[model samples]
Target: MVDADQTFVIVGGGLAGAKAAETLRAEGFTGRVILICDERDHPYERPPLSKGYLLGKEERESVFVHEPAWYAAHDIELHLGQTVDAIDRSAKTVRFGDDGTAVRYDKLLLATGAEPRRLDIPGTDLAGVHHLRRLAHAERLKHVLTNLGRDNGHLVIAGAGWIGLEVAAAAREYGAEVTVVHSGPTPLHSVLGPELGQLFAELHREHGVRFHFGARLTEITGQDGMVLAARTDDGEEHPAHDVLAAIGAAPRTHLAEAAGLEIADPAHGGGIVVDERLRTSDPDIHAAGDVVSFPHALFDTRLRVEHWANALNGGPAAARAMLGHDVTYDRVPYFFSDQYDLGMEYSGWAPPGSYDQVVIRGDAGKREFVAFWVKENRVLAGMNVNVWNVTDTIQRLIRGRARVNTEHLADPHIPLEDLAP
Candidate 1:
């Protein structure tokens, strides 16, 4: 049992940090817990920021991780608007805020999340340019989108990744003219590859969204500190009132790096390296969530997942490890996305060149199908689009590692459970 004198400090007021604090208490740890957040608001999930909240389908209160009273009732020392600038490893303390209040910890958990990658082009400092990563940015974007809808303004979004496509759908729903600029031929090319990425391209085109393929945003021209237009490398200029840089995010590892913790190389996705138990270079210092690069036994690789489910499960796993429990953080990677009427849940990892064949079950034309990435007759990963109640069976196939008949895998009539066994 942890003594009452022991203190556990978790940096970064995000879903992972908040959930870690909750797990400590649930597991009967009576040690002092200090959760510090840079933002003034409490910890909350980030998915809704780009999806429902941005679309106005969800309310402001729904985005929060817990009720305001839950933290105090549970005796969690919640510090908001205080950023940890440095970590004194030898002294075992962290100093923060304007006053430089120092807090000592027996164990330190780094859950500092990622920051959005900004466009390096000109006119990025313009008033009408926007990027969505935090609640505050979403709140400002919500107002910008609302005004654009009411005034019949056009919005040009850079990058055709998940964030870009989701925001495109939301903007279209709000009656704003939407155009996406991407260097790839289709959306989500880095994740879904060209085969499935083309499906999303068609989906958006049907919704009246324009796509500028094989080019990137070179410049954003503006007048009087407001956006006027976006110029592409292909020499095409798109007229716009507002611009959303829906580019991807980079992991926030400066604090971890400054503390002399070993960081993963760019090929490994650039994060703080952690073992299967989520232990960093310093045994007392652990890292989890998006900031961590953990070794996955199943995939035989070190993966740094920036998905919602990773944070939801990684936090509790790290908490248990901190309590000296036998923990192996080997949960299958899972993530879901909602665009228009389509909903998808992707399980396992299947990057390009990692899989040999992609078999489809059900009707792709109708937007209801299960696509499997197979390598040498074994299922590496599977994605269910507009198809429900098969994630369990799909994960079973991945974990089971049994050879599946390629013919049966593509047959909609054959049940997924039967093939795994």
Candidate 2:
């Protein structure tokens, strides 16, 4: 166990880093705890950036993890808008990128989160093209969307992932025409499979959003450094006064790489490699959040999850492991999204091609269904769409690993709890 006099340093002031500081204090770690963030604002929930905040339903202050006074009250040092350039593992010090300011630590936690991925296409740096990752990005997009009502222009989204669909919904709510271009045949096809993905595609279609499926954004053409249209590989161009490229995100792993940590293989997106306890190769330096690729107890291969719940839960697990406590950082990965009038909650890990078949219990056409991904009658993952408060039961069925009856599983009359072992 670390002594009370030792100092703990946490990099990246996102939800993961904030939660780690909270966990350290709650776990009775009296040592010095410092959180360094690159953003000017305090740590905040990012999920709201795409949904409530972008829609102006939530205030900016409410997105922050805590008030500015809360950090000082807890005796936790807050280093805002600081970039950590490098980590000297042998000396246990993290140096700043700009002024080379260095701070030594007894234990370091790397919660450096992911950044939005950008395409190498033309006109990416144009004025009207944007990507949503930070609060600043969302605020900028919000301003553009506010002007769309007067401009009478359309928003062209480059990807059909969770962020793309959610933003499309919000933009449509604000009276801007929206068009989505995706490489897949249906929205979220890689994750939810065609059946469920089509349901989402249909949901957006019903809400007056256009989709160009099986297409790639070849270039984003602009006039005078402002986005004008997004052209696709199929020789089709869609008018877009504003463009949001919600392609995906990549883990911010430059610091970890420079520190000589064991990064995951290139095939696995090259995240920092960590054990089940979230410990990096260097015992004193632990990694959590989207930047980590750790072995899952329930899955065969190493997995790296980028979702709100993973960051919310993984931070505490990493903190417990840092205190010389024996811990296995294992939890059923969960994620949720709200698009238009539909809301969904998915639990457990089922990568693409992992599950053989999907069994649905309510009407998918009506947009109220509980879908279970099964292989050999063992539930791999489950999703409840427009259905409330059954995630616990769904997760249990996946963990129990009992043989399930497909007929009963598809019967809406059967309670999900009864399917569990």
Candidate 3:
């Protein structure tokens, strides 16, 4: 039986932290559960912030991970708008807020996620410049979109990653003129690489979105505390009623670093280092979500995934591990995105240099296809675009780690099931 007198503290109030608390209860751990969030709002998921919620299709209430009453009903102590300043490892306590109030814990979990990387450019503080990372940010952006929809305002977006592209799609739907500025050759260059990135670029172009590749904002020109235009390093100027900085996000790891936990190096994407069980260097403390960089034996490297699926699954996995259960979180990395009329689900990890060639199984022009990244005829990763119900077989092929026939993979009639066996 679990210790009912024990206290478990979870820091960060997002999907990961919320799910961890729920798992603790579900696993029959009758202990005091304290969940601390820097934001005043209850724990919520982040995907909707940039997608449905921002598009006005999803209500604000739907973004939350659970109903407001669920925490109290489950006997969880939920602290809101409270930032943990430090972790006192020696005393086994977490100090928070201006007064440095301490909360002692027998075991602790750090689910601190990531923060949007700010652009170091002039006029960023202007009224029309924004960043979308939280519920509040989306709220402001939604209002801006409504007004832009009515006024036909021009929105200049910096970066062409998922956030930038998603917001661009939303802006276009709102009847706003959208221009994306990206430093790479095409949109999603870091993730999809050039080939698939070009496909996205074409998709956005067909939706009337303009692309300014090989450029980044050198300055944001404004008048009367309102954005007017953005000037790029390539000496091109684009008119802008509003500007969005969606460059990227960095893991929030100050507390973990100050507490002297093992941190992954910057080159490998810095994050709090954890084992396969999501256990940190300190045996009493574990970590999950974007803040966690753990060993993936399957990939033969350490990875820190910031996608929604990571937090959705990692939290419960960590919670079970904290409860002294045998847990090996080797789930293959997965993420999906919706843009315009096209939707895609990608499984496994394949960066630009990691795979030798890409094989296509369907019509790329129709935007209905399955693409696989192969290295020496072994499937490293697969993505299904505007295709459905093959995630299971695709994941099995990845986990199989055996050589696959490129002809079978490229043939649409050859079922994905056949490739696995």
TM-score of each: 0.98, 0.98, 0.99
Candidate 1, residue 126: lDDT: 93
Per-residue lDDT of candidate 1, residues 11-40 (tens digit): 988999999999999999998999999999
State the lDDT of candidate 3 residue by residue for 1-421, as single tens digits: 4699899999999999999999999999998999999999999999998889999899999999999999999999999999999999999999987788898999999999999999998889999999999999999999998898899899999999999999999999889999999999999888888989999999999999999999999999998898899999989999999999999989999999999999999789899999999999999999999999989998899998989999999999999999999999988999988888999999999889999999999999999999998899988889999999999998999999989989989999988898894
Report the C-alpha displacement of residue 250, candidate 1, in angstroms: 0.4
Clashes of each: 0, 0, 0
Q: Is candidate 2 or candidate 3 better by lDDT?
A: 3
In Å, residue 207's CA in model 3 sits off its true spot by: 0.5
Candidate 2 lDDT for residue 11: 95
Best-matching candidate per lDDT:
3
Candidate 2, residues 1-421, lDDT tens digits: the string is: 6788899999999999999999999899999999999988999989999999999999999899888898999989999999998899999999974788898999999999999999789888899989999999999999888888567779999999999999999998888999999999899887888868888888889989999999989999988898889999999999999889899899898999988899998687668999998999999999999999999867777888889998999888998888888889878889998887788999987756888889999988888989999989999899999999999999889888899999999998887788887
lDDT of 1 at 391: 97
lDDT of each: 0.92, 0.90, 0.93
Off by over 4 Å in 2: none
Residue 280, candidate 2: C-alpha displacement in angstroms: 0.7
